[model samples]
Target: MNTNEYPTHRLVKSEDLNHHGTLYAGRSAEWFVESGFVAASSILNPKNIICLKIHGMQFRTPVKPGECICYTSKTVYAGKSSLAVYVKVARVSNLESIIVDGFITFVHVDEHTKACPHGIVIKPETEEEKLFYKRASELGR
Candidate 1:
């Protein structure tokens, strides 16, 4: 795969927190999907893309207020009309610790919002990419 990463950063504010004083799941999900969309759209027209599914989201840790969370997304797999994007969320100060990670699938559509082929193809070039490509294919099945 290209392994091109699209990164987005967000500051955890009071409004982004939950009752337990940590980042809310809803907010995180929104950003995660957005990041995935960016990755998918990078290879296709943004106006022709729509999110089809969120395969899974794993939250390994909680994010607190004042922390700058970075969301990095990359396209790991692509089918005729769909792309699987993997997103990783971590603190900018400590990229080693992943706060969350997930895969989202997006489809290319025509002007009528019907599924259409996206002519993009990705070839895995590394062991990590190969693993993610395999996982993405399994998710499609």
Candidate 2:
């Protein structure tokens, strides 16, 4: 896989906040899945893709309102019909502070919404890529 990082950002607003004034989990999840979908759709037609699973999502830090959250996603692994997308969300002002991270699995489907072979193949060319690929492959098992 290429080392390119597909990025999307959202600003935390009053409507996006929880009772604690932090970003809400449901809102975060919606964006996280959208990020993964964008990453997977870059390789496969968006119309042919559907989310198959969402692996562990861990929120390590709270994001407050008015903060610009950056979501970076990458295709970590590719199988015959599925792709594992790893996503990381952090504050744009404080990149070191990761708010959440997770993996989302997407599969290519036909017009009937049945899984179909995407014929997409990815080979890791860097150590970091290799590590992510290994981790994503494990999710499939």
Candidate 3:
């Protein structure tokens, strides 16, 4: 793990689950996207951000209600006004493991025209970010 990498924050919501007694897949996906948003914004433009799209979602397990869901995200790649964020989710309560993992794409847009502006800056502060950028670039093509 990269020491400089930002530690993920926890997100909890009572209405995020479904009647199945387990966390809903849709809710999990949304949370994952939100996590990506948090991570991307913190690195790219801490003040303003916008989610462009959710690329894909994959669930490894189901999260339970009352369990603290932790979403960890990192800046994988950035270009102009767009940044790709990779995120992973874990269900914690008395020590549990990952329940889901995914990635989200965000575009920094001007609030007025809602168009992606030029010269958006993203600084990769760790080796992890560099490696992620390389990997993401390869996969992106």
Candidate 4:
């Protein structure tokens, strides 16, 4: 993992499960946005950050109790007033096997809660990062 990628962990429990006895989508979504927010807030003021959109949620594996998962996110695209974050949910035991993956966008706001520029720019440095940046840039627009 690179420095840009932030990781958050969650331990599955009964309360976090669904009728099928796997982790609930609601709970998973909560963690998804929270970690995306962290990735955004890490570079900007948390008080000035607000989530704008969460798209492309892809759940590939069912999480069961006793399974530990990681939510790793990074700012893949940064615009004048917005950032598109990419988050991947994977079991700690197998990081390459994604359990879920998606994009979350956040906007920097002024004290009046109006969108404002954050004065940050992001450029992809690797081929993989370029792919992520391309996809995220499409979302930012």
Best by TM-score: 1
Per-residue error for 46 in candidate 3, Å, reads: 5.6
RMSD of 1: 1.0
Among these predictions, the greatest lDDT belongs to: 1
Q: Scored by CA lDDT, what does every candidate get? A: 0.92, 0.90, 0.66, 0.91
Better of 1 and 2 by lDDT: 1
Clashing pairs in 4: none
lDDT of 2 by residue, 36-85 (tens): 98899888899999998889998998888899999999998988889999
Model 1 local distance difference test score: 0.92
User: Which scores higher on TM-score, 1 or 4?
Assistant: 1
Please report the TM-score between candidate 1 and the true structure.
Answer: 0.96
Q: Tell me each candidate's TM-score.
A: 0.96, 0.95, 0.71, 0.95
- Comparison by TM-score, 1 against 3, better one: 1
Answer with 2 or 3, whichever has the higher TM-score.
2
- Clash pairs, candidate 1, are 1-123, 1-124
For residues 1-141, write the lDDT of model 1, one tens digit per residue.
Answer: 475999999999999999999999999999999999988888888999999998779789889999999999999999999899999999999988889998999999999999988888899999999999999999977
How do all the candidates rank in terms of lDDT, highest first?
1, 4, 2, 3
Candidate 4 lDDT over 1-141, as tens digits, reads: 232889999999999999999999999999999999999988899999999989998788789998999999998888889988999999999999999999999999999999999988887888878999899888844
Error of 4 at 131 (Å): 0.6
